[model samples]
Target: MESSFSYKQTVPSEWVDYNGHMNDAEYNRAFSLATDAFIDHIGLDAKGREQYQYTIFTLETHTCYLKEMHEGKEFEVVARVFDYDAKRIHLFLTMYNADGEVVSTLEEMLMGMDQDEGRPAPFPDLVAEKVEAEYKVNAGEDTPKQVGRTIGIRRK
Candidate 1:
């Protein structure tokens, strides 16, 4: 559980939407970049994929846009790992503007995969141990509601 990882990016012209703000797809791109950074921090990288045939596949995601972002604006993304199990990881990411205001938030759940077989697989012992250690350190640091929140309307 890294407290945070930072990434810098400039809004791309192609990412602009009809609303004149960064499009929804761009949010996913930023989140994906942040996820890669976190994975690299935990000893997983492209090289590891070739050697271990392990990778992560996103299972689900929820994002909230709180403010508008325009093309050519510089932004930063921060990511945190809030929870994980033998095969799954829960992550939270925040995008911020140069003024330090949050522009969006993304929540995602991912599962480990056997790249060779393209199937869900349990995390290796060494990788699981590292993730567990980080989970312990970051767990309970944030309220349960924040950690477990989902977007959209709830059905009765």
Candidate 2:
């Protein structure tokens, strides 16, 4: 619940594309790892899965590639909760290179679901409380434009 939750990862060779940089898919992978870390921080993990039968599924995502990353590069991902309702949460993630420069940013919308029914459901009360606490603790001082954004082409 600090300003950001950080996770370190090494770029794998398979993540490199013909362009010789980390492929677009790997960006999502890194963000996904960060998401998992957040979930764990809030007490959601294999045990939560077994007991609550609840999990998050990504509904939408927007990623901006600001700089290229290469295979074997050590990088870090910082994630924070931007917003949340009963069933959905908005998260912002920044991928940083070894030098701490932001290499990419991703915004994602995730929905809590009942794994058995595959239907949307409100987050469990305990999980909801934890998430709310985290949001309060981590909300950034500056209002980031990425929060509550919709995908579209801008008209100049």
Candidate 3:
């Protein structure tokens, strides 16, 4: 198993939808926040952005909602760096309940951005080293089923 980063969060009442479960957008929001935390952990926080003019932008994301979560519920996200290079990162985040049952999964590709040029750029050497280390630590684990899933109708 991979050594994943954990981010704990509480479901807010405002995130509930008409059916009383957390809205679809909220799931993405939670994942986004977790992604921010991961970025900060990898030394890409506000200070790093200011110093190196570098940051991260989500290139794409695929989220699978496995179980409905209600308002006031406590959840945690476990994040892993599945892969990364000089300019991109492939990550997987799983949201789990207090009991450790998975509630959602998100697979994402993120690009490192150069703020001054407002375009993709390779990470600075220090940041690249950290990202590579994270990827190496996580890539050796058993792959989760949600990774690389495509959305389509499958015939029985």
Task: Indicate which candidate wins on TM-score.
Answer: 3
Better model by lDDT: candidate 1 vs candidate 3: 3
The CA-based lDDT of model 1 is what? 0.79
Higher-lDDT candidate of 1 and 2: 2
TM-score of each: 0.82, 0.86, 0.94
TM-score of 1: 0.82
Question: lDDT, candidate 3, residue 94?
Answer: 91
List candidate 2 segments past 4 Å from native.
Answer: 1-4, 148-156
Ranking by TM-score: 3, 2, 1
**Model 2 TM-score (2 dp):** 0.86
Displacement of residue 13 (Cα, Å) in model 1 is 1.5
Tens digit per residue, CA lDDT, model 3, 72-104: 999999888878778999999999998889899
lDDT per residue as tens, model 2, 1-156? 245367899999999999999998988888888888877766678899778999888898888888999989999887777789998888888888999888988888888988888899999899999878868867665655655567689999
Q: Kindly report which residue pairs in candidate 2 clash with one another.
A: none
- lDDT by residue (tens digit), candidate 1, 1-156: 235457789999999999999998888888888888877766568876667789888888888788899999999887766778888988777788999888888888989999888899988777787777767756766543445665579889
Superposition-based RMSD of candidate 2 using all C-alpha atoms, in angstroms: 2.3
For residue 151, give model 3's deviation from the true position in Å.
1.0
